[model samples]
Target chain A: MMKRGSGFALSIMLLSALTLSACSNGEGAADGGGKKQTINFVHWRGEDTETFNSIISKFEQENPSINVDMTVFSSGDPYNNGLQAMLLSGEGADVFVSTPGSLFSTLLKSNAFEDLSGTPLLNSFSPDLIKSGQSDGKQYAIPYQLVYNVPVYNKTMLDKLGIQPPKDWDGFLAMCQKLKDEGITPILYGYDVSPGQLINTLVMNLMPEDDSFNKFQTGEVKATDPWFAEALTRFKELVDKGYILKNASGTKYEGALSLFAQQKGAILASGSYSMATIAKQNPAIELGLLAPITTSGSDAKYEGVHTTTFMLAVNAKSKHKEAAVQFAEFLAKPDIAAEYANATGQLLTVKDVKYDSKELIIQSEWMSKKTVFQPRLINTNKKIETALNESLNMIVGGASVEKTISTTQAEIDRNLTK
Target chain B: MKTRNGTLWLFIIPGLILYSFFFIIPAVSSLLLSLTNWDGMTYQFDWVGLKHYGDLARDPVFGKALGNNVKFSLTVIIFQFGLSLFFAILVMKNTKLNVVYRTIFFFPTVVSSVSIGFIWMFVYDPNIGSLNLLLNSLGLESLARSWLGEPSLAIYSIAFVQFWGHTGQVMIIFIAGLQSIPKDLYEVANIEGASRWNAFRYVTWPLLAPSATIVLAYTTIQSFKSFDLIIAMTDGGPNYASEILSTFMYHQAFTYFSFGYATAAAVVLMLIIMVVTYFQFRLLKADRVVY
Candidate 1:
């Protein structure tokens, strides 16, 4: 009874403290002209929150009438829960980050954004980027950054080995074989299983022949497609050949990246964004970007990706609708995009934009000249992604590709049906 | 009297409203959501009652996650409780500099979990981890491997971490429980010619039951909902060896937008927690423990 009483008392005290903090902050913000209007800006870039806040500072300067209250969810938890909870309560973020995933579409249908179809800033964005931001018949979100998935290799290692860059599947395998013979692990990948594992990079590389996502997304492809099976086989082969880091199934992204930076590994299955990070961490780390390896023989196709390009959406229930639009417009500006790219290691969709980010410059140049755009289709289910990631991790770690692929196909089919 | 009761009810109304809005409503709606095929964010979710649950039965990942969660919970219940009790007893022993020791021990508990997770990752670093590096410098090279990267060792490494991160909280609870126990019991046990183990087994153990119950509940929930540690440590990877239900749910819903499917997973996890807690509460018949 005493313990219970003490526990209750502690809770009450903590509650009071939280309430006090809330009231004081709320009061300080609200002490302005009549009833002050605050825009709740929600995002998941805490590692870059300072940069985000600087952007917010610019927004506030541009619109002196409004104060921006920010909500930052660490990229790990990613704020989706809090967002979902608030959204369901009809009181979510005023200006929020939107993805092409299910939640973004839900927010769109719920009328959680203002119609910005004919806005002045509309002409500033790329036609493809602007189109990617559409839902039904309205433009709700603004494409913020374009990210691509591909293989990155050690330039010094390949050069020292006197091997040309892998242009096709056979060339890639030959490179892998050469690296293996030289006692170097070919691809340093983190395959920790569960859903959404690093399989996306491998899968993208292996399935260049098929626009797998395009087919599955349009309801035009079977879950049991032969290409997916082929992708599975290729992933298993990478594992069987010891091309992947020996303990990749246990390694984390940070671990893998660190190893690659140390020159202990040859190839890293990473996105274009990583070039800048690699350079930042190790400036002298001679790196080269390659097209995601698909089909090793005569069928090799070096496809590019336009997926993971994030956008900002005005919350449907935002009170400061005009200000939110202003925020999106600001983020889309080439100059602002350049700054954001420098800060977040990404690129603006406008190819010609000279980003302050050297990483963005290198990646964008590589992308424009070669890679294919694999936009993450809006119709894809996250469970399917998870299943694919898990299945790929399993395959790479010596699990049966056939069973895992079939199971993944079944899950994808089931989720799509739902 | 009626006015006082009315005032109390009025005060409680806000709390009730908040509770229903934040907790009860979501819990109820989640049940409704589990019956549908909501992509989690899109407005177009079709009701597919029990379909997801049926599919979940065939999900190998679900089975793996479930088994892993149970194993984690059971380990946490044992090691965490055992370590906490040991520390609590040691601290409860009359000694000088107890405060300093207590503060030092609990230092980790007060720090943000993210910090601990990151620091521990460094400690377990295969090449540069201070732990392995120290061992190697001391000519113990064979003992070190990629602690976080090896599938066979990742889950245990992570579980041990959580055990370390949480031992202080559990210890404090145990300390509180031990202090609250009357010293007269020890004296009475001595007069009865009981050995220290016997006295501990009969007297101290029974009195610690309440603390045990609370500790078990906390660890059970924590282990079942293990995410931050796993995300920080292994992210259920190398090959999903360390994945628990929370990571699985987050990946399913947020990463892919399978809200209804994720909800089904969440519902299953919740049921498991409730059942385990219930069974434990019944097992202890906790009412038998006298203050």
Candidate 2:
């Protein structure tokens, strides 16, 4: 009898413990339809994220049925580095943005993102934009927000020097000489190699001004073609002329921005993102976006266009797929697009949505003419930037432009294939 | 004593379990991971056996990174050890300003590393930084260069900042070691007519070796693992001049999403550290001091 009683008590205790454990595991996971839904969004957008945050609020108010759990990632490498590791470990966000090149290609091949094909969201977005999001015509992510890298100059300085925006490469050099002769630094450059402030600077300087972004991505022309080399050489000549700050070779991206913002330097080769944010922060200085100087003459066949696509893709493994899709649909609505565009000072990606900012409207017009989204970095060519950085560093170290450019061509040729 | 003997293992068991779960399991898994080409996503992996190790030999960037790591470790090991020893001795010299000197020297170590990186970045600012401003103001314009931006000087520039920040830790450790050394040994040396340098050489130096060894091993490991300084100051840039193995692993795993290859790189680092541990234990093994 005593043994029977003790055995029964032990069984009861074990049952109670299992119940407790099961309840803890099952809590908050069970949800019936029509209840409030929560979506997790993560990105590396930093303090410039205010515009994004306001847009999120507008989203929540309009669709009170959904709640967004936004996580702003720390800036620098950790933002992107740990993102997928978290995803693969089943711990990352439900919806996140990724760069649209080799990283995206690699992720898509791994079957990391949910298919958006033939969905309501798919029909709503531009097919060309989706094509840009895909490899050989399969969609993995959507264009989040498109931006273009352009050259920005100090308007007050330009006016003082009575310089009209240079329509040709020679005129640009003469203007740089004028700025230098006056003891004002001609260019605020941070040659801090690779993905430094160089991204927009070099691209704007080099990209052919005449081709569609689509043609460039589709390989109608090559990045190493003479048009790019001419641009590259012209950009390097500014360095040789000592128009760019000497310390720029060592400058990091942020270092150059802060320097430019302080009005210590005149010419800045950067992005549209720089335009909106710098305008807000540096109230003491006036900024004007101009046609970036190019290697080709004014009548050159190509004009560099600056446009970027930021996508928000749902993680496939999440159980909240329905909710995630619904939230994505909400994001695609014209109203949602307006909120995002207005907040970011970005031109919206949705066709039906009206461009909000004047800058956005201008950029949209430019994108229609001659802009190529920088080639989505090929996976095999992922290390291409390292070569770019090394070459840039070599140039600043006083290496011959001929040697640097040829060596870069050699590296890309050797490595961009398996 | 009885309770200690009885409950020591019992007390240690929880920590041991946690350590095994968190550190040991992950470490073992890293070794397993090193053999595969899993991109840190999904359960799928391609077993490459020793390919990653072989690839390490062919990887020029990895070679550059490894060389950088070794140079950083050596530079930190020497200066960190030297300044720490110098400060420890200075503070222990029974002088009037010793305490104040010790406090000032140790202040940098207490601040965060990211802050150190930022502060140094400003100091090296080329356009309008105080370092250059001061230099130029003093008519030393020729001496001003972007200290952190230059390819040849960036590595040293970063290491010096680290030395300023971490030398305090070594100094504090040495101070403890110095405090424990009996005055009687010094008294005997004084009676024997040995000079100050001679006393340090014969008496103080041998006693400080254990502490020095501990500091050396610690700083060596830390210097090899130095990331925040490089990340914040340069992000291992200006043509990969300041790139270290850890940063390279970081790029592969975090930035480039080649985490499987990155894990392989980490495994190499772990092996190097294990070798270093063995080397330190062999070299620093000393008889126990009774005093």
Which candidate's TM-score is highest?
2
lDDT of 1 by residue, B144-234 (tens): 7778766677777888888888888888888988998999999999999999999989998888888888888888888888788887776
Q: What DockQ does each candidate score versus the true complex, computed on alpha carbons?
A: 0.31, 0.52
CA error at residue A71 for candidate 1, angstroms: 4.2
What does the interface RMSD come to for each candidate? 3.6, 2.1
- What is residue B48's positional error in candidate 1, in angstroms? 6.1
lDDT of 1 by residue, A301-343 (tens): 4455555446677777665677667777777777776777787
- Give candidate 2's error at residue B201 in angstroms: 1.1
Count of residue pairs whose backbone atoms collide, per candidate: 21, 16
Q: Is the docking of candidate 1 incorrect, acceptable, medium or high quality?
A: acceptable
Error of 1 at B40 (Å): 5.5
